[model samples]
Target: MGFCGGCAKALLIVFNFIFWLSGAAILGVGIWMIVDKNIGSYFEVLNLDTHDQFFKYAAYILIGLGVFVFLVGFCGCCGAIRGSKFLLGLYIFFLVLIFAGELCAGVLMIVYRVQIEDKIDDALESSIKKEYGESVTITDAWDVVQVQLDCCGGNGPNDYVDSKFVNKQSEQMIPLSCCVLTNKGTAEENPKDAIAKNGTACYDKLGEYYEKGCKDGLLDWGKEHTTILIGVGIGIACLEIFGIVFAICLCRQVDREDKY
Candidate 1:
């Protein structure tokens, strides 16, 4: 290979290795999203049978894209090392497809961002009012959210005033998840192991329950982490762009050598 070709090959190999690592990271994230009690519970409360499965759908997409990227990175690295035009071309095609998919996903996120927020708010409130204590999945979801976010109900402990969960109890009461825990971090870590600071029901002990609402708490959490997410996204985009350019340059160099 010529100097330019050799440089491109080396860069391509390095970029593809990074891409492969990223793919694995994405896959791990996807799996985490699926299994994580905290985040996964949020969508489970939406009840896929009746409500939008937005988060669940996103996790599945991530998994599929991650696998695709992993294989494409392998192809690109092999193609660059072997100086094979065919593999390089195939790698480029997959990159283009991934870029398009990302563009579409970004557009969809922009368009539905507000709508999703509103829907999630409504769905969560509805679940607390009607599904809590009735549906095991939704009950668990709310418990997890309340414990993890250090918040209560859709808005606050008051949100359960006329809720089915409260009405069903022998007397006015709120979920233990809404109470101040005896074990500070354990309940947040595992709701099933949650222990309230006192035996008193959260409904009667206004001072003991979390004043913050889950909705506001969730918004605050998102704000705190948004910057990290954005930075990672931009970094990935840059890497992909560089990978495409290097692949194309190397392809041309291979063609030039073959023509001679």
Candidate 2:
């Protein structure tokens, strides 16, 4: 019995250490998502003006959960090492709470995915029509997407016609981001600064601009990375479950030793 208890305690400590590392990793990822400019551009594409809270809330939740997990892991290690029944019980409680919260978050993510699919077109149209060239944030976001995805406007250069950006231009033009950079002097230059290969006005140079629309480009990009996302989610869930079981078993061992 003494040997068994010692083994359980040692295993629990090791598990908690691993859990602590996982928490730190999650925290780092959460912070990165919040601050990374490239990632922020992707979020901007998904974020509708009226539904902008989603991105902020998602980041906050990740940060909060990461911190909570970090603390719980520390508590779990202490409880196992000192054989403190009270601390063990508290650790178990926190583990269960985190498990439940993660399930809820998963469901919420699925719902958010659906909502994004339904509203993305409308959001893109609204941004192009009213915010393009007018809102620096929106314009930068669109430019990033257009260049990275090799796409034009929401549905190609035609989608920009009669829009605020095009209307305000002195010459008939699409966004510089839409222009294809293939000229001898421009091919090596930055796409943002490169002139169009065929003509100055991007709308007239149909062959010189990307015909793919950003709307489809964004969706396809998400699909390409779905497997990675799902794998990460599953990995975290397994880690949480592993922590819960270890804490519970150690608590039982402690209780039996106390009664003996």
Candidate 3:
């Protein structure tokens, strides 16, 4: 039995229309951003720091995804008008591919280790005082890590102690981070929800960058760490455009297939 020529067709047509429109929008934004100085950040994230290679890859992928989505939408529209089952089936296959690709990319992004090195270049004022006595000013913050437990907390820290979060790796390997942090330094990767870790000698610097305390520190970090935001925003856009393409294909398939 073929698809009932009412709800399914209507659904497909609606989604196809939306995706086609979105495809154009994505392409437009990507193109404008590529040219605009303001949009350079997105390119960097998409490329992962290589100005030339990443920029090209990011631009191509974004534009391709948008165009693919537009094609899917167009196919759906044509299939609906012509009632072509082959076009519909092809659309369905493309939908699966697009969805799988985006899902895989997201998973890989989270799991991949980039070996981030964070440094606070600004020195505390000479007169600044700490509880110990005077806030010691270290010229280089290379080893001076500002620690936090809630790596995956309500908000994240400059340092994501995914290392400290679980015995995940330590179950097999000796956790390099936890040993120093717990023994010599301050902070917990897997902090007790009820209790935040204690001890000042360990030098636990408490405070959120955005919503909580340490407004100045957070502000400083914010301005300095804007590059990260660039990568994240563009990567997200790539995933989203991929999704739009999938939706378009799915709509077309539903229009062509037999069965709801």
Task: Give all candidates' CA lDDT scores.
Answer: 0.79, 0.73, 0.42
lDDT of 2 by residue, 1-260 (tens): 47877777887888887777777766776787677676666667666442367667877777887898889988988898888989988988888887787677667666766787788888778778787888888777777777777787787677787789987974756777777755424332334555666665465654677887888878776555544555666677787787777777778887887898
Can you rank all candidates by TM-score, best first?
A: 1, 2, 3
Residue-level lDDT tens digits of model 3 in 1-260: 23455545666677676667667765875576467542342122122233467656766786897799788777766765566766766666676666566566545443432212122111121111110011112101111222232111112222223323222332312112212233332323221212222323112333212222122333344345444534544454454455445445445555556455
Best by TM-score: 1
Instruction: Output the better candidate (2/3) by TM-score.
Output: 2
Ranking by lDDT: 1, 2, 3
Q: Which residue runs of candidate 1 sit more than 4 Å off their true CA positions?
A: 45-58, 222-231
Q: How do all models score by TM-score?
A: 0.87, 0.86, 0.42
TM-score of 1: 0.87
Candidate 2 minimal-lDDT segment of 10 residues: 183-192
Poorest stretch of ten by lDDT in candidate 3: 126-135
Q: Which pairs clash (backbone N, Cα, C closer than 3 Å) in model 2?
A: none
By the lDDT metric, which is better: model 1 or model 2? 1
The residue-by-residue lDDT of candidate 1 on 23-64, one tens digit each, is 887787778877766665765654433234766687888898
**Which stretch of 10 consecutive residues in model 1 shows the poorest summed lDDT?**
43-52
